[model samples]
Target: MTIIRTIPENEAVGEVAEIYADDVESLGYVPTHTKAMAMNPAAYGAFQALIRSVAKPLGLRRYELVTLAAARGTRSQHCRLAHGAKSLKLFDEEQLERIARDYTGAGLTDAEVEMMRFAEQVGRDAATMTEADSQRLRDAGFTDQEIVDIAIAASARVYYGSALQALAVDVDTPPTLGEPLRAALVDGL
Candidate 1:
């Protein structure tokens, strides 16, 4: 249960309803985060746009990877589950589980591992970064723009994940989202 109310997709009104409609169009169901963000659709949309902008440079898969790592670093149950389920599109249960358990041994590519580390570092302590950190990303084959995108995605998790966890926002029911994925998300949570 959550202190914050999670407005249902059908019950949403005004701009929030519009966003919920769009979410259903894209994802087949409104996500928990979307329901929570419905408190202010304009700001929520802006944040989504920012995430999209970040993903444009980093790509969706990389963005999801960063999100998973950032969420795990922050111990955001909703995020870990949501992102773990999303990553299922690119990775298998074994892979996602391995990643959730330990990214270093998850058999990810060096580049992906580096990005994961970057996300964790960004979520844990961005203030501790130095030029060498950027250089490491460069060595991992990421352009400066891509690195910035990684930072943005991870930072977004820090912001949104913190709020969601602090408010104890409850995730949506699994029925509409179907099997396996629902199981994955809930179990991962």
Candidate 2:
């Protein structure tokens, strides 16, 4: 359980109420992370906007891949489970399990593998990154814009994921994710 107190769904009002409503409508239940972030609605909105901006250009498939890699690197099981479940839209259970186990050996293309590698680096330590990282993506045929989007996507995850970890928020497992894949994501390869 998290140490911070957050607005309860029943007592929510204004933007927080709307955010909770949207989550209930979409996810059938309010996510714990939502409650934690909703402690400040403005910051939560800004975070959502940033996530939307990152996801738009990369599209959902690539976006989820980068998110998963970053979440893994951050050691954020909450994000790993969330993004891993979202990844099911792009890959079957078996394939997703393979990815969660070892994305490099998950039959991804060179470009995709490189993209994930870069995201992992971003989540792990962006300060340590050098031009060689971007150059690798360039060699993998990613445009400068795509590269920028990838970096932001991963960095954004680092921000949110790290915050969630700091707060010690409980992980919310998606009901759709099977046990094997969930274990792979939560327990690592």
Candidate 1 stretches with Cα past 4 Å from truth are 6-8, 172-189
- Residue 53 lDDT in model 2? 94
Q: Which candidate ranks first by lDDT, i.e. highest?
A: 2
For 1-189, candidate 1 gives per-residue lDDT tens digits of 577776766577888888889878866887777788778878888888998889877777888999988886676767777676667688877777767777888899999999988888887788898888878889999987898888889999988988887777875543333455455444543
> What clash count goes with each model?
0, 0
Q: What lDDT does candidate 2 reach at residue 61?
A: 86
lDDT of 2 by residue, 60-178 (tens): 98999999999878989989988887788899989888888889999899899999999998988899999999999999999999999999999999999999989999889988888
Which consecutive 10 residues in model 1 have the weakest lDDT in total?
173-182
Runs with alpha carbons beyond 4 Å of true place in candidate 2: none
Give the whole-model CA lDDT for all candidates, comma-separated: 0.78, 0.91
